[model samples]
Target: MTRAQHPAGDPGEVARAFEEMPAVLWAFAGPQHRVVAANRAARASVGDREGIVGRPIREVVPEMAGQQIFEMIDEVYATGHPVSHADRRVLVDRDGDGHLEEDFYTYTFLPTRGPDGAVTGMVVHIVETTRWVRQRQAVEARADDSERRYREARDVVLGLQRSLLPAGVPLLPRLRIAARYVVAGADAAAGGDWFDSVVLPDDRVALLVGDVVGHGAEAAGVMGQLRAVALQALVSGAGVLDSLRRLDTLAGCLPAAVGATVCLVVVDPRTGDLEYASRAHPAPLLLGPGGSARFLDGAPTGPLGADGKPARRHHDRLGPGELVVLYSDGLIERPGQALSAGQAELARVATAVLSEPVAPGSTLPALTADRLGALLVERFAWAGYRDDVTVLVAERQPEPPEPPALRLPAIPASLAAVRVAMRAWLGALGVPALPAQAVQHTLGEAAANAVEHAYRAGDPGEFTVAAGLDERGVLRLTVTDRGRWRPAPDDPQDRGRGLMLMRALADRVEVAAGELGTAVTIEHRLQRPAQVSAGAAPPEPAAEAREVPFRIEAGADGPRVLRVSGPVDLATAGELERAVRAAGRGGLLPVTLDLAGVTLLSSGGVRLLHRLDAGADPAGLRLRAPRGGAVHQVLALTGLEHLVT
Candidate 1:
């Protein structure tokens, strides 16, 4: 029943009912806030409020003396107003440990009015909320720790996988080579699919592509062993059949029950002579310069480890200007699809890519081999695919030579030309998208610095941009200018970000300054995009999430408040975005985000908020101002404070 409906008959009964209330309730008299009357809960909390009557609150709870509680109580009494605080921290003597224990509570101080409308005393009410707050903190801590460990493990696996893969196909005379590996979308670790090229005794290169039965660390290990053994056998003067037989026997002796399908093709670079053996792998696609494509689907043995079958050798000669494609089944196998259909699709795409005209003045092998492999991976590797794909393109070239380096005048406009040339160069080298972008960004920044800062505007300075792939497939670009070096000004508003951007993007950035000129060199190790989705934009490091440093304080009958408190830089912006999206997911209308606690907010964080605001109903989401701190300064500078409610 409502308290208004239950009439109080006597003062004694009313007092008894007040004493039985659950929460801590008490009254104090005078501005000094001396205890006057307290309920049972208050008495139990302070170990006898009756004995503490007529005493100041400090005398009973000394821990509250130097804290804000005293000032809060005084403010209520003087202004005849009420104050409410949720999640208020206080020190309590619950365990009598000779020291106060930290606790959280919801506290309220209401002014008690006298007959003349003057405040004579105050009523205090408290509800403990320590258990809930502590539990939430513990959960968040555990989640952060778990995520850190998982990321570490994934990085280790990816590093191991990259180390095992070929750095780049060895530059065999008269051979144009390109290869790609697309890891499964769901596999954070490495998979079994791999490609390798090893030079044999008579200037012939053995191209191999293989796929183990399963994926992950174990399968990658087996794939590594098989690849190593097969390459060693060929180096030991074993023929194609002998190498396959040896690999089959080796697979049988492995401790784990592992099986694999492989295609081994040995090609004489001088004559386009090829002797290939397929162990139930996808038939190799041969593409001619005239746009005709054919798959060599000869009678082949079962996958390796099958006891009764010996792999049969098939002899083929790649005519001059004809390209041979070796691949794993992951390239063609799809759920519930016929293998023939996939094969047909592959032949059609390969033919189309081959038919495209080579860039004017570009060699046939340089233009076609790189373009074909990139085109296939770009077209086929869709998101959520379960298999790992490996494609290797080997073609006979006429004295395979490197692309020419670029040189340009030292001017701002020259940066764009340099960028285009570098991109084309990196692409011809078959560098994956991630490293390609890194090289392009780093090179562009260095070139811009040279054009704008290294040379005087009217000095007629010329900058040269030279790029080359090293023996181990590392792309190194050097931007050199003839003018002296000029250090960037020490101004946050204008200077020094370019160098930071360059260092962040490239594997290594080295700068040398002499009287003649300044040179900036950038190095990036070229490898297949590891732990990344193919055909999709590689996950930008700027968008990666660090620990989420924020909290949500909520109430049953009011707007939910999310308080974010940390430097929201590029790495942490994603976490802040996620926090806001999660809060909105509850359909909790009129959710208020309090940025008062935020120490910093970057442009990325600001953009994230704007995007959310653009998608949100204006009345459903409100942003509180960042109250004169670094966050406030940032919002002011970016003109983002207008988004605040």
Candidate 2:
């Protein structure tokens, strides 16, 4: 086409337009690839404009020598074709400095044909894209960092939740317990859900489940504090309402604990009586032995730190072989579902799982409770829970067997037999060695009173020792003799020392005199460890005889330390007094009596110590006993704690 036909399409017009355009444009000629024309953008990109036109492309941009741009332009010119690249990295010394700077660009190389239709030269168009590329990279880096921080926070919250939960449930004679905890979905922050069980001093079992508001570390921390406070109150024999009241007051102090929810239930394993209180928590579910399930939602209260109204206590009973379940709201909450529907689904799933016949030889409620809890968690949380899920199951077993009874004559010799028999009985009942020793010492004192005071001389009266472990787990021992009950003497030196010892050791002690005889009954509650299973067989007693030869080794040196070993009781009290007298050497030097090896320190030994202290100087006699040992505990209980060194 001629320039006269379309003035705008003239070569000069096109060249002028290219010179003023913002894009980099250049025209190359011949095989040497000389620069035929250069635009303003082109000169600016090279950071120099002097002597650029009519120069070879290599002379104008010397930094591009090793780059593939020369070859690409040559290929386009020879083949009469076009080539394009996007975001290509290029290094250039734009400021004429020896150092090279990196940048990104998109460029196209187009061939220009001559009149004979042969490729004559190439036209190149280039655009810089460095700013856009860097922006995109910065955004991606920020996203990656945010994701890493979120994962770390979730891990910390999860760790806190697990650490705050109960390590293991208590094992009681007539009760079985098990618990399970499940975290939220993989991408979600951890929610606070926890469960706990404790055996109260009155032999009642307390079950607790709680959920703190919100998610992450704050929620977990609040849940931990609430759990600790609730446990302390309940284990200390606080009533259900009283414990919840304490938690309510505590919630007022903790900002994060506001609106937290908890359900506390105390059950009497012996009678299947349950007393529970709620703080905006879900009701407990009772699973009957006949596969029937029901929710104990009769009583409900507002959340903690809400209205000042006192929480109401609810009462229920668990039948034999029936199990009660306490759980966090997460166990029954489902997305896009009503609360009632979720609860019904939970009841259905639990009943279905528990309806199946129990495995043979798994009659122990512990195994059954464990299986139930695991199955419940599996059924409800298998699809990835949105909140933390927790479930606790407890079932009452059959009544335990009665403890054995013992009968012995009212004499000093019967003291040793009483100790041996009581030791065997208490050990069989899964009682710890320390408590067992305490019980033996208390019963020995009761029996010794019968031998020394209950019957007249030459009366030949007999005393019967009857022992039983009541449903409350209190060890009860009754010593009866067909004799008179002696009253305490007015003189401090001649007072009823054995009676004082019995009262100090046992939880409750009673002495009664009637037409038939005088009876001394002692009661002490047992605190068994979690490792001891319900109705575990009594461990076999060691074959070694109980009679450790009573001996006193008086060191003939400074401080006069006397090492005493063996059973110190009514039969050996005289020997002990005589040995101390002989070792005292006129009571001039201080004497330390080490009772670490004394297996049994009865009231007779305590009375002897009192007499020795009363007659000698205040600092003349010192008693040495191992800390926390049976003998040490005896001395502490008998009001002789100050005498122990």
Candidate 3:
């Protein structure tokens, strides 16, 4: 460790140590900035120092000749003030490829002052920072990409929430409904808030408003499932409380830690009575005429999925022209406001709206609903709402008057009036085309019979007809006459066919005759095409099959036999189908469907026979020869004999 033994003790070794520094160091000795001495780092950046020394830096790295670095070096040379840059761009042949590559470096240029404080030459030092700069930029790019994905995910969740919400309010018979939905924030994902107006099995209107546990796609998806379950329960005849309990049970079966708050209000359109249940949800606001308002919050249960506790039901009488507001917490909940305060504010707004006089012109129920919903949203949830907001307003419409009955005098004009009234009523009830036509026909026949046979010219009796569709989807028509009965003609041809025609068109026909009056009742079961069961095979005739109107006989020796002894029409087509099917099932070939005993033949009967013949197995059906009877006349007019033969 003696000084003489140390490498620094020798000038040559010292010089070599200085030459091997990691930084790029060099000294320029002239105005042109000629390189006088350079370190190994500098030589490595610009190639061997043998020919580079004593050359201007521009000559060593030609790419740097016209760039700002030379100008900065010249400024330092002229002012004698040192200059430093943290990330100076420099080009050099670091890879010894002859062509220079661009890179970043921390560099400093200083004036080497002489004895009289005058600048003599320039000294330079640099450290490459290209790798660090590139690494920092890569990290920043990754952060930006991650933020973009987060926003995209939020947008997708928002879209999902919107898709699952109800498109519009239901058009219940006695309700004017309006609703609105708002999301929490622009950047935040959509939360689980929803509202619906569904028609329950009892024909009551169920108004629902709910909020699920959280935000984003998961909450929105859970909201959809819970809404469906609640509606299904109501549609299946569950009461308000029962429906909420059912939803709570369903929520329990879902993934753990999920929960929701719901409010269900079932309103009976007939009585203006509302049965409501709440699952830790806020109360509904009742706004009446002249700015009267109150909150229906008596019933409260644990939030849905909270250990499945049974819920309580509350009842309130909602009169005509009164408004009921149901909403999620998001509607009233805002910063610096308690839930009770929000509820109070909502009541105030609802009352204000109610106080406004209805415009001179009529306002549509849907438009009123929309206007109220918009007002409530604008009042309480305009800005900075931290949760999804949903508001539903329902106004009880006045009970509609009972449909009028037709009390027509016993005259030909009365028959047409009955038909017109029946058709109008059927159309209002949304009766399908097929069932409506049948009703019109049967009702017309009953009225016409009363006009033609129930009274004489001097008696001038009156007749009344009434029709309606019951909750079971059955159409009922009642026709009554206040006249003396007339005896039937002894000959079949002379007797009228009014009674037979009515029986043919209706599913059931009931006739009662007395001195007071005669009343006929006709009933038809109305079924949507999709609801008719494919397996509703025709029933076999009763034990008194011989007394039945239609009979079938199967045989291989000749065509099968289907004999009709009564009028063949809508009411009796089913009997013919059953007989035909029974005969066909017996596997008899070349079946004969005989219509020899058909006293009357209607379009319904002809239609059934045509379908059977057209779809029968090849050469499967043949008809017995007709001899100018009603059945033969119908076949000849309709050209149906070709299929049978």
Q: Which candidate is the best by TM-score?
A: 2
TM-score of 2: 0.46
lDDT of 2: 0.74
Cα displacement (Å) at residue 248, model 3 = 1.7
> TM-scores of the models, in the given order?
0.43, 0.46, 0.40
Better of 1 and 3 by lDDT: 1
The whole-model lDDT of each prediction reads 0.68, 0.74, 0.66
List model 1 lDDT by residue over 261-376, tens digit each: 88999888777888899887888999888878898758778988875489988888888788999987787776777988778878876775565433332212234666677657
How would the candidate models be sorted by lDDT, starting from the highest? 2, 1, 3
Model 3 root mean square deviation, Cα atoms: 28.9
- Quote the positional error of residue 629 for candidate 3 in Å: 53
Off by over 4 Å in 2: 1-173, 176-206, 211-401, 486-492, 526-560, 585-590, 615-619, 627-630, 633-639
